[model samples]
Target: MNETDAKVPVDGSPLELALTAWREALGEAHVVVEPDALEAAQTATFATTQRIPAILRPADTAQVQACLRIAQAHGVPVYPVSGGRNWGYGSRVPAGDGSVLLDLGRMDRIVEHDEQLAYLTVEPGVTFRQAHAWLREKNSSTFITTIGGSPDASLVGNALERGDGRGPHADIFQHVCALEVVLPTGEVVETGHARFPGALAAPVFRWGLGPVLDGLFSQSSLGVVTRMTFWLARKQPYLREFFCTVNDDAYLWDAVDRLQALALDGTLKGSFFFWNDLKALSVTQQYPYASVGRTPLPDPFRDQFREGFGRWAISGALSAPDAEIGALLERRLATALEGAFRPVTFAPPPPDGESHFQGVPSEANLAMAYWRKRTPPPQAPDLDRDRCGFIWCSVALPFTGAQARRAVEIADRVPRLFGLEPNLALLAHSPRCLYLVTALAYDRDARGEDARAHACYRALARELAQAGYFLTRAGLQAQEASPSVRDASSEVVRRLKAVLDPRGILAPGRSES
Candidate 1:
C-alpha cells in the first residue's frame, strides 16, 4: 500500500508501531494518548483502577477498518465505544485494562431515511437526541424508541447490548434490522439482507437467507458495528399516561398479575415502570442528608419515606388509533387496577413533546446517581467526573405476582445488610418477563466505600441468582462480581469467538458467557 499504511512489521510488532499506524490511519489529532485523556476515559462511575492506554477517534467505516487492521497486525487489543455515556454500567471503560479505546463518537451521521419503509439508518455515533431532532427536522411522523439514560447515549450501542426503551418498541433490539460491522480481522460486512448487492429489502427485512447471524454481534466481542438500521414506530392519534400508587404489597402483587394481561393483550403500549420511593425521590431531589442524618436511612425513616410516597409507584402509557379506543383501554385499566390501589388516573401527554411515550430524549432521570451525593446536582450530570458511585444489578423474573414479590423481598432485604439503601425498581417492558433493576449508590470518595459497595453488589447478584433470577444486562463490574454472567452464553459464542477473534483483540472479555 501507500505511505499512509505506516509500515507493518514482518513478525511480532510492538505497540508503538501500532500506535504510529493508528495516527497515520486516523489523523494525529484524533489519536489521543494524553495522560489526562486516557485517565478520564478509563474512569467509571463505580470504583475502578484499570488504566486505558489510548483513545482512537475513527470518523468513518474506512478509518475504523484501518485502525482494526493496525491493532490486529500489532496484537494490540482495542475496544470500540459509541458516545461513551454507559454511566451506571462502566461508562467508557473496557473489559480489561491497557486496551486502546476506539471512540466512535466522530462517526455521527444519518446515512439514510426511508419514510415509506419506516426506518432510519445511522452511523454508530448517532444518539437519541440527535435522532429525535432529525425526525423533527424532516417533519416525519415516525420516531425511534428512546432510553431513559443520557440523551447522548448511542442508538447502535444500546441495541447491541439489548437495551429496553419506551413505546410499542420497548425491546430496542427487536426494532433494529440491518447491521454494518467491522470484523476484528479488518473486514467489513453487512447483516441480514444488506449483505446482498442491490437488495431492496435490506433495511426492512431482519433475517436473510441461511443461518441467522444477527444475534451473534450483539453483546459480544466479535465485531465493531459501524452502522445499523432502526425501524421506527408510527405516530398514534391518541396518547394517555396512566399512573398510580401501590401502598400494599398484596395490592402491588395482584396488580403485577393483572397488568401482564394488559401488556400481553393490547391495553398498555410501551415500557412501564414500577419504581420504589427512593427511585422516585432521587429523580426529583437529592438525598435528604440533613433530615435523615445517616447513611442507608434507618428502617423507621425508610418506612416513613415509603409511607409518604407510597411503597411503590406504577407508571405506564396507553395508546390507540383514536380517543374512543384510548378511552376503552383506560376503562380496562381502571377496572383491573383501581379497586385496591389508589385510583388509576389518566392525563394527556405534555405539550413539550418530552413525554416518555413520545420517544424524546432527556437527562432528567440521571439524577438518581446523586441521591447519595453531598453536592447539589448540576444542570447536566456527569457521574464519573463528580465521583458519583453507582452500580446497576438488573435481573429478570417471570411476569407473575409471586415472582415479583419474592424478588422484591430479596432485593429489599439484602442491600441493607451492607448498610446501603435498596434503590430498586421493576421495569415492566414486556408481558412475559420484567427486569428487577437495582442500583447501588454511594460516595466513592469515602474510605473503603468502594469495597463496601462492590461487596454489596456481589451479594445482591449472588442471592438474586440463588432466587432463580439472573442478570439481564451486566456491566464490567458485574462481570467481575459474577463470572457466571460471562459464561451464561451458549457454546456457540465461545466457539465463534475463537474463529472470529482468535487473538482476542476486539473488545476482549465482553459478553463471554
Candidate 2:
C-alpha cells in the first residue's frame, strides 16, 4: 500500500498507527485520542474497566465503512457503541482491551417518518427524546416506544439490544422493520426488503421474502447496525395510566397469573411491569443510610411504605380509541383477579406524569443507580460522577405465577445475604415470558464495594441459572451467567464468526449467549 492510501507507521505502537489511519479516514476533528477521553470511553457504568486506545466518531454510513476499513487494514479491533448510555450493561467500554471505540453519536438523523404507515426510520444516533420531539413537531399521530432509560440513549441502539418498554410495541426489537448494517470487512448491507432497489415496503414489512436476517444483527457481534426503521404505535383518543399494588407475596403471585392471561389474550394491550418496594423507593427517594444505618429500613418505615405503595406495585397504560372500549378493558382487568390485588385505579395523565407510552424518554429510573450515594443526584445523574456502582442481571422467566414467585424469592434473598439491596422488577414485555430484572447497587468509593458488588452479582446469577432461569441480557461481568451452550450450537456460532469476522476485529469478547 502507498503512503497516500493508508498511513504506514514505523516507530509508533499498533494503536498509534491505527489512530493515524483513522484520523485520515474520518477527519481529525472526529477522532478522539486524548487520554482523558479515552479513559472515559473505556469506563462502563459499573465496576468493570478496560483500556481502549482511542475513540472514532463516525458521522454516517460511509464514514462508518471507512472507519472499519481503516481498522481492518491496520489490524486493530473496533467496538461499536450507539449512544454510550448502556448503563448497567457495560456502557461505552469495549469488550476487549486495546480496541478503539466506534462512537456513532454524531449520526443523529430521522431519515423518514410516515404518519399514515406508522413507521419511522432513524440513524443509530437518533435518541428517544429527539424522535418524540420530531413526531410532535411534524404533528404526527404516531409515537415510538420509549424505555426507562436516559433521554440521550439511542433509539436504534436500544432496539438492537432488544430492550423493552411500556407501550403497544413494548417489545422494541419486534417492531424494527429493517436494518442497515456495516459488516466487519467494510461492506454495507441492508436487512429485510431494503436490499432491493426502490423497495417500497421496506419500512412496512418486517420480514423479507427469504430468510430473516434482522435477528442475527440484534444482540450479536456479526455487524454494526447503522440505520433502522421502527414501527411506531398510534396515539389514540382515550388514554389513561393505571396502577395497582400487591401487599403480600401470595397475592402478588396470584395477580401475576391473572395478568399473564390478560396479556396473552390481548386484554392488556400495553406493556406493564411489577416492581418490588425497593425499586419503588429508590426511584422516589434515596436510601436513608444515615437514619436507617443500612439495616434494611426499620419495620415501621416498611409498614408506612406498604400502607402507601404496598410491598410491590404494578403500573401500565390503558389506551383505546374510545371511552367505552377503555372501560370494558378496565372492567375486565378489575374482574380478572378480583380482591387478589389492591384497588386498581385509572386516572387522567397527571401534569408531571411520564408519557413513556407516547415515546417521551426520561431518566427518572436512573435514580436507582444513585440509591447508595450520599449527595443529591443532579437533573441528569452521572453514574461515574456520583460514584454510584450498578450492575443489572436480567433473566427471562416463564409467564406463570409459580415461576415468578420462585424467581422473586431467590432474587430478594440472594442480595440481602451479600449486604446489598435487591432492586428487582419483572418487565412483562412478551405474553409468554417476562424479564426478571435485578439491579445490584453499591458505593464505588467505599472500601471493597466494587469487589463485593461483583461477588453478589455472580452469586445471584449462578443461583438463578442453577434454578433453570437464564439471563436474556448479559454484560461483561455476567456473560457466563447464561445457560450452557450446546456443543453443536457453539460450533455453529464459532464457524459463523470465523467467516464474518475471521480476525475477531469486531468486539472480540462480546458474547451473544
Candidate 3:
C-alpha cells in the first residue's frame, strides 16, 4: 500500500483538509478558524501567558476524534484543554511548540448525577461551581463537594492533575470513578467497566479486573478526557471550622505529626493546613480577629500575632449527633494537642459575638483567600514595589516528624539564597500516604524578572531532584534548569507518546522532541 493508505493522509492543504474533515465529521457550529476568534479562544485558557497555541474547537467526541485523526495524519501536535483555568501549573494552555489547541469547552455537559450512588459523571467542560450549583438545585442533599483554587476550574482537568481539596478525601486523583477518552488514533475508549458488555452502568470499583488506565491520562498529554465520574463527600448535619495557633516555630513539625495522627485516627473530619505568619496575615488581612475594621484580640493575646508565630490551624466538622460530637471533640483535642505548647482553639463565637471560626463563605477558604489578597489584586501592592512571581517546588516526603523537620529546614533555606522568604504549605494526601511540602519563592517583578525567577526555580528544582525528590508538577523552566527530573520525566513521557500517538501528533513537543 502507498504511504497515504498505509498510514493516514498528510499531503493535502493543512487548514482546508482539517476544516473539511471536521465539517464532514462534525456539525458546522463545532469548527472555528477566524484568526481573531482563534486568538481570543486560546487566551481564554490559563497558563498561556508567554506561549499560546493555534486554537481548534471540537463540539463533541466525534469532532475530537476527527481532529485527532487529522493531526495524527499530518504530524501536527494537539493539546487538549478543558476549562483553561489550570493556575500555578502549566495552566490549560499548551507549552509552546506550535500545536493545535483542542478546546473542550464546547463539550460541557453533565451526563449523569447518581444521587443514590453519591457520584457525578461530567464532561471535561463542567466546572466545580456548575456541578455544585446543579447538585443544590436538584435538591440532592446527599452530597457535599470539595473544590480547588477556583470554582471555574474544570473538574476533569483538576482531577487529572491530582489537585487537592479541603475535605476528608483530600486528593482528587483518589476519587476518580471512570473516564471517557478520545485517543490519538481517532478511537473513543471508555475506561472502567462502562465499556464491558452488560455493564453499561456498573459501579466503578473493578480496577482490579484489568490494568488501570485512569492514571495514565492524569498529568499526561496522551489523550483527551471527554467525560469522568468522581465520588463526592456525603453532606454532614453539623459542621464547624476552627483555627489553632502555635507560638513556636520549633513545634511546627510536632503539630503536623499530631494533626496527621488525628486525621488518620478519624479525629479530624475536614482538611488541615499549616501556614507561616506571613502567609496567615496575607490570607486573613485581619490579624488575630482584631484590627480597626474587624474585631481585635486583646493585648493579652497580642504576642500571638507576632511574626514567626508558626500558625497551625485546622477546620473541623462535627458530623455526629449532639451527644457524640462533644465527646468526639474532647477525645480528639486531647490526643491531637497533647504535650504541645498552650495551643489556642478559636471556635465559632456564640450568637452576636465575634467567632474566629464562623461558617465563613466558601470564598474565605485559605487558598482562595490568600490568592485574592496577594496575587495581583486591583488596588493593592504596587506591582512595581511588591511585584513577585512564584517558583513552586513540591515533593512527596516521608511522613515522619524527623523527615518533616528536615524538609522544613530545606524549604526554609532554599529561598534564602535568592533573598526571598519561603512560603510553605502542607498537603496531606491521606493519613499515611504522603505529605507534600510545597515551597514558593517571591521574585520581585523587575527588569529581567523572568530570567531571574527562572534561574532561582531551576536551581531549587535541581537541588530537590538531586536529593531524590520528584516534583509533582514541574515549572516552565524545569527542563533547562532542573534537568534531573525534567530529563527523566521527559523520557518516560516520550516513550508513552510513541506507543499512544505513534504518528507524532497528539501534543508533539509536550513530551518527545
Go through the candidates in order and give the clash count of each: 5, 0, 5
lDDT of 3 by residue, 281-355 (tens): 545552332232222223344345553344444334434335467566656765676554445453442442111
lDDT of 2 by residue, 36-80 (tens): 676666666566556766779988999999988877776889999
The 0-to-1 C-alpha lDDT of every candidate, in the order given, reads 0.85, 0.83, 0.59
Q: Give the C-alpha miss distance for residue 286 in model 1, angstroms.
A: 1.5
The model with the greatest lDDT is 1
Query: Higher-lDDT candidate among 2 and 3?
Result: 2
lDDT of 1 by residue, 1-513 (tens): 122322223343467788888888988999997776777888888877666777899999999999988888888999999989898889999988668899999999999998878899999899999999999889887888888788889999999888888788988998888899999998987889999999999999899877767787888788999999999988777888888888888889899989998888868877888988878877888777888887877767767776667888898888888889988999998998976546888886567445668778878888888888889878878888899998888899999999999999999999899988888889886889899988888888878888998898899989999888988777887866654544435687778888888788998767656
Clashes of 2: 0
**Which ranges in model 1 have alpha carbons more than 4 Å from their true place?**
1-13, 352-354, 483-491
* Model 2 error, position 183 (Å): 0.5
Q: Which whole-number lDDT from 0 to 100 does residue 41 have in model 3?
A: 39
Stronger candidate by TM-score (2 vs 3): 2
* Candidate 1 lDDT for residue 156: 92
Please give the distance, in angstroms, between residue 508's alpha carbon in candidate 1 and its true position after superposition.
1.8
